[model samples]
Target: MNKILLSVLLIFCGTSVFSQDTLLTILEEELEREFKVLSKAEVPVYYMDYRVEDETALTITSSFGSLMDESNARMRVLQPTLRVGNYKLDNTRELANYYGGGYFGANQAQYLPINNNSKAIKQVLWRVTDFAYNNAKERFQEVKNSDIKNEIDDFSKEKPTKYYEPPALGSLDESYWKNTAKKLSAQFLGDSKIISGTVTISGSFSRKYFVSSEGASVVQNFNFIQVFVSGEVVNEDGEIASLYNSYTASNEKGLPSFDTLMAETKSLVENLQKLKEAPFAEPYTGPAILHPRVSAVFFHEIFGHRIEGHRLKSEQDGQTFKEKVGSQILPDFISIYSDPTLKNVEGIELSGNYKVDDQGIESRRVEIVKNGKLQNFLMSRSPIEQFSNSNGHGRSQIGADPVARQSNLIIETTSNISDDKLRKQLIEECKKQNKPYGYYFEDVTGGFTQTSRYATNAFNIMPTLVYRVYADGRPDELVKGVDLIGTPLAMFAEIMQAGKSIDVFNGICGAESGNIPVSAVAPAILVRRIETQKKPIVDIKAEEPILASPLLNKKN
Candidate 1:
């Protein structure tokens, strides 16, 4: 979900020569300078924090067996937060600022380069510190003008944590990424029915430095390499359909072999071809079986987002689980939790694991549900009633303000049956419900949910590969065009069985703050009843290829 291409914005000064300078040294030097100046203000800065990301990245893309683009560069992201008022009535959670964005802080998209002289870097820090302070003051005044019953404090106690990260997995130069992209993209060539195919490989190594007025200092580093392959085809009904296959790892050695990537690309092309001829599904509401991958996304979209602590305080949020903490929100055998400290599970590296959160709090495990009962919420420094401490889930996308977000969400169940048993249960439910067939959600592209009171408290998960399982035990048939839609509470209660094998889905999840990487691990589930809706009609007219890909002058 994060498209990190090299930024070409004009530079006012020379670029940062990263290897020559230590990022921590620059951060400590600036934090001292900015704090000294801001300490003398009339209102005085009660709290201040500086966050920087020094990243080097490479991106390579190819389409239809030819190179499309390639870029490599470095980026340093800057975030500074200065709170002027007390913790309860700070310069945050205030009315919108002049820019119609949050008043808590101004996210600086670009900052001074580390290669610049000390004086130049200090000047940039001073300006950013000043900007944060002014916004804080405005928000404080607005808080006094407003009247809302706020039961929870504005901020929780400051956390003191110190951690120096290990060096990232070794960085590979540009040649490696370029060659990989070429081979992966070539798999789509010569496939007659595939309209377009593309492959992209992106890799990055980055270190984050953070310091706070509350005596917190942290340095964390990480590296990642991702290969994404996708194909697109238009159906006879003038609808666009697409499929994706992605692999992620912390280093080159962890990535799947070249042969595996080629096979995956071929599978994606074959699936898209099948979808092109699959019959469109009618809107239906009945029993369904979610494959492990589908179940992972289902729980993420319909459940994980609702229990973030900050959402409970917002009047705009639905607060579906707020008062249900002591009650059962799912079947008696099910439970859910989120843990950011887990680096890997069963040898698979997780993209969501982080040593420390953006707010300098060490990552921890949070049990949101225990044995089907609601337990707690994912928390940041911002607390809610009965939960006044951070559980290390406060996260952001570099420049944006931090909020409570899910990390590595894990869904567990004690009543786990084998996949064969789960499908048997699905067929039984379909027959009992008097439906002709039940759906098997095999693979999903992505999905979204709404937890606001202003909109329906529901979710819609987009499915790319779906099938119909007959009640009489006939062979499953591929189907096209249906969205998994449901209300959260109802859907949770409908689940009756789970599979033994677990699967994981990883991507960058976007919320009020920004997009942050997340993962969901779950077993397949059998729901007695589930709902789906027909895809909206597209306006594209059916026709022959405008200019058939002149490959060997073959015409469709």
Candidate 2:
């Protein structure tokens, strides 16, 4: 955390030179006023917190060498979280507060876009604070009448550390990115099989400020840049298969050179071409090898989402890991952890790095598993069972409330083998299981998991490229139309081995709260047993090809 330095003008938050104090004097004054009034009300309030986010973003997108959209905007929001009751049942878990809505709702971010005048900012804060206080008071009364008691506290005790830093207002060169995206998308113009091609260049700079009645104060900023290249074609069986490559950096200096990007672009076209003629895969249940990138995504969706502390308290969630904290949930050689403090590893900048979480707690590395045994859950201020304090995992989008979310997830292994050895081991397992060949997952676009009680406790990860490695020493054959799937508990037990090298995946994760940036790092792993289901593609073929362009005319 950096110290705040007052500037001469407030360019982003407010439109005046006098509103330049990095101390957030406007926020302090409003919070102090509300705390003094609400804390001593008929139904006394225990805590009240205020959060504000100032985000400035620019996006440039192109398709087939033509600019599609360009956006440059700035936004700011003020949100107040007021609570009643000691720790058992606060305004947070109450149903009445949300149903009896006022202006926006009992719980919603209050917009303060016109912050040029101090009175305007304070006026919005006063209304928001008053509504929240009333909701908390009514909810606390309901809690007193109920007989059920909670196993864990509604809120964790405050652990505050002073932090402040004036964010940098970086000037963006939009024309540069606009041209870069055009160049990347132009690569697919000459390809006949490619159905669609697009590229998007995105950059953002954001700063968050937090102050609570409990004496917590913080300010921090982040910079993010990403370039995405994507294209796709229908396979022989009329199934859509695509290839995507993303380049991430902390700034323009970290981005790959144009020549380097072109090379990657060439590879993407070649892979998509192969998928055009590749045979469709049949449903199979056997052994498989997940590449480093695919494995990172697999563990992230299958295991990481289940360990969030808030899931245990929600009656609608699956709560898969709630009862297995002390048990061996994975193979003996594997351990996993998450750290948002790490910005770069081996020259690659991570997306999940942060100084302090949205709730004003300093980010730190948390050990989630030790020797395959579950250790602790990813927690926000909301506590559950044995864990009662935040470990800096609370995260969310600008206008959403904070929740426990994954950060820079890293998977560790005590026993590691080479990539070649891992593949050979997979083949050996396939033969033992009486299967002719095993699947090798090359790349994954994304994945989703279902943790709600009503849905099946399963995960399905869509793969972009997969090949069959024969057990009898034959060349690997490309295939399509299979999705990796299994139950979390069973899949964790089938881990056969892990590779020596590590790779990282950076993306955004969306949950009940909102979409938050995250990263997953891990090595390739061989799973002894798993299953794949065929994609439900349209069985009928196209009646006639409008342009039997060489790529699609092969069926003739």
Candidate 3:
């Protein structure tokens, strides 16, 4: 979500003159001749950087109306980011009493020369920067023979940034997204209890570049386009119902109309045949509403990986708000904030809109919970305890290594009300907790959380539209399989009210620095109790399908 304009791409050039761009003058002349011979060896490196990227893609898939695949790609990767011992202590810190010192010993995302040659891209950036400075001098000699004595700071001294953005190219058509995935997978071949009707369609384009020995010269450009649509069904209690819906854009005229993706793929094949005739949900607890895209994946996996400031100096993580900064944590009329320089909000599009971070800093806006106290945390040049630097949300993916993740989070609230008064306060908190039906959830395909210390700080989510809401006024049923579990300070101490319409989700977000792109934004709320379970049945009877679909043949 970048594709130009960081003040018109940093007003053209001059972050140390990027030497008329021959791949940033051979990556800043091999990062100043390999930092003058690694600044004279012996655990010296201090810091370094390089990043690369390039990318470029296009994909398409379809199912019921055929065309299974189509692709076109391009590559270039790289990554290199080394730091030995300094920035207050390095080897990328967090060895916690040294458990075999790893610090990227096998570095990753190498391959680079999608041809801008300069001696084959400085010989694969001088052999991955001499294997990332001999794995940062063997993890800085195990953090200088650790008898473990640490006081924060394994790097946070920012001040090197010189931006630029020139090389830009992104164009897709590829037969109009392969006929828009065969016209939305031929509308799931008119049902026949649709067992799998797909449609994919992708588009990427990266660019990146970067460089530094602490002189940082950047370049950026991103662009995405997505449109997915899925369906799968089984029903009659053999239980296997799936449903999907996606659409992100930063181009392709900001995506949407194709009759609005064929009316959301015919409402995702009529919600996969009403989730194969609903009814499965059992383990409940009480009152709920969620749905501002399922509370934006329930506050991105229950409160965005517990405020990532390198997981409060990981002693195996679970640092859930490390001493809750200013306490509260939710419901003073809620607040949250993340903003990777927000690209779009009221109009959607935000796969974490970046304009720098992957550690050349830049992006900002991090408030992390406001009215409900708690305050700041998503930093990145790693350094916790009253946060040190990086509000840029470092990020990763393309060979992992930057962290402080979550990007466009958002949240807000301020006592809003009305989605019919948050569903009449979720049936008046299920008739004041005597609960006779309450849930809602509606739409989600992402969820996962356990902030470490070896799991179970809890969170599950995984709902793909749920429902219930009764309390004697009947109607509103459609349930299935369960799951939306809890425990993020007991689900932010049972929210209680929000609504006034807002939404958005966007995708991709693995962790420990891997699958990037993210976004959240919320609104619908109501909680008051929340909890659920039952959702594990996975046998797929050896993936059923004993012949039928020749477009559901009764002789076609």
Candidate 4:
């Protein structure tokens, strides 16, 4: 079988005679046995694969000087997939309807033993593989009976990949982390304006074992360490405002020190205090500058999702860029690409980096756009017109089918200027448009987009911190309740310029596949004309607690 041993040293997790690599051997053996038997069937199993992930996670949280909770969890999930019929037409094909062609099916993940017990593992795999095979046969019949027909192939032919990386174990000092959370959360204590404050730290590690009938075997491992601090406050007008900041790393050593965490928590509290008293913004449309972090998220939501290969195949999708290929989508100076092979930008670790996608395909860099022209879409094993192969973009959570998703989406520009120059351009553009002032989007929490044909193909970016840059040369004014809203094509045309400093935004993206880690990198950008709307106000008076906190009520 196709396997790469990390080392000769024996690795043990639980009470079992088998080592970690032994698990992959067992998986390959079971896959061969099942495929041999199923290939003889009348319909036949054209393709089959297994993805098993062993995950161990821990969470520590604190609020207002008190430990809220501490917990640890572990589990193993197995996702089995078998396709009936050939690559041209398979059980996974989408059925066309009046609205459009789109279908999502779940393969109910099976739980397996945590220990490396070959016997127990095989038993679980045997049951799931049989179930999946029968389901594939039934779906294949449905596809054959569909009234609509399409020339696009149901799946793409990809060369089998054999790759492996040594498993990385997780180490946690519970006591140290628990105390860190408590200290960080205490930063907001004794502040009367604050309504809520919380600090949390989480770490997770997963070891994945994959095997396919086409001679593909891959075993990889990843880990995440995150520290999050958030705070909320109420203003005199009874409008409540909240803000948050987070730090992420791949390993425990990469996590920030206690001093850094404390300083960040302090800054988060101060920002929330200012946000509470900031004036509520009104709807406006004019020039604006998006901070590097904000710009990264802007592209991720507005442009990145539309370029996913599967979306172009689905009739239900807007297919915004499907026909726009070879056409100018952004300014000639701007270009875009997604690289899962990028582990870090500078020294910051990217959460989206991976050695191999869930499909057992080796990850590679995909240049999606060049010189402002649409070049390609992020592809998976599913083939669309023109693009017949996967570029290792297929990804999914533990229990879902793999789909084309973004990794490290990097937006670059040929013409770059300093942040000062970008801001000056924003003011000049605002004056040219005959506006009194423009806005600066400093940071964002997160945002979403709609790519389906049934909806308006629009995007809304929720910015937590915003500033009104005055054209009259006055000090920038902080403001609240501003949301960056616009359509994809219209918004892409408004780019005026970009800054020299590049920033990174790392977060999780949830879609048809599931929630997977992702990152976006871009420099600050100036938009010639953009729109904004007001966020809903929370009536703090109605929601205010009737009593003070016990910790504060106690006499000194």
Order by TM-score, highest first: 4, 1, 2, 3
Write model 3 residue lDDT over 1-556, tens digit each, in one string: 1111122125554444556677878888888899888877776787788888888888889888789888888998888887877888877665765342224443556878788889988988888889878877887777777765568777777777677877676777888788878988888886666768888888888788777787777888888878888888777656777888888887888888788889888888888888788888889888888889889888888788888778777787778889878889788988888988889987778899887888887887867778899877887887776676777788888787887889899988778787887787788778887888798888878889887766678889888779898988989898888888878998888787888888998999897677888989898888888889998889653245577657557686
In TM-score terms, candidate 4 sits at 0.94
Off by over 4 Å in 2: 1-23, 94-106, 538-556
Q: 2 or 3, which is superior by TM-score? A: 2
Question: Could you give the candidate ranking by lDDT, starting with the highest?
Answer: 4, 2, 3, 1
State TM-scores per candidate: 0.92, 0.90, 0.38, 0.94
Count of steric clashes across candidates, in order: 0, 0, 1, 0
The alpha-carbon lDDT assigned to residue 322 of candidate 1 equals 84
What C-alpha lDDT values do all the predictions have? 0.80, 0.80, 0.80, 0.86
lDDT of 3 at 504: 91
Clashing residue pairs, backbone N/CA/C < 3 A, model 2:
none
Clashing pairs for model 1 are none
| Local distance difference test, candidate 1 | 0.80
* 1-556: candidate 4 lDDT, tens digit per residue: 1111122111234423223478788888999999998988998998889999988999999998789998899999999989888989888888774354445553658999988898999999999988888788887888888875678887777778766667676767899989988999998897777988999888888888888998887777888888888888888766777888888888878888899989888988888888877999999999999999999999999999999999999988999998887899999989999999999997888889998898878888888899999988998888888888888899999888999999999999987898888888998998999999999999999999999999899999999999999999999999998989999999888888888999999999999789999999999999998999998664436355677767678673
Off by over 4 Å in 1: 1-21, 94-104, 107-109, 552-556
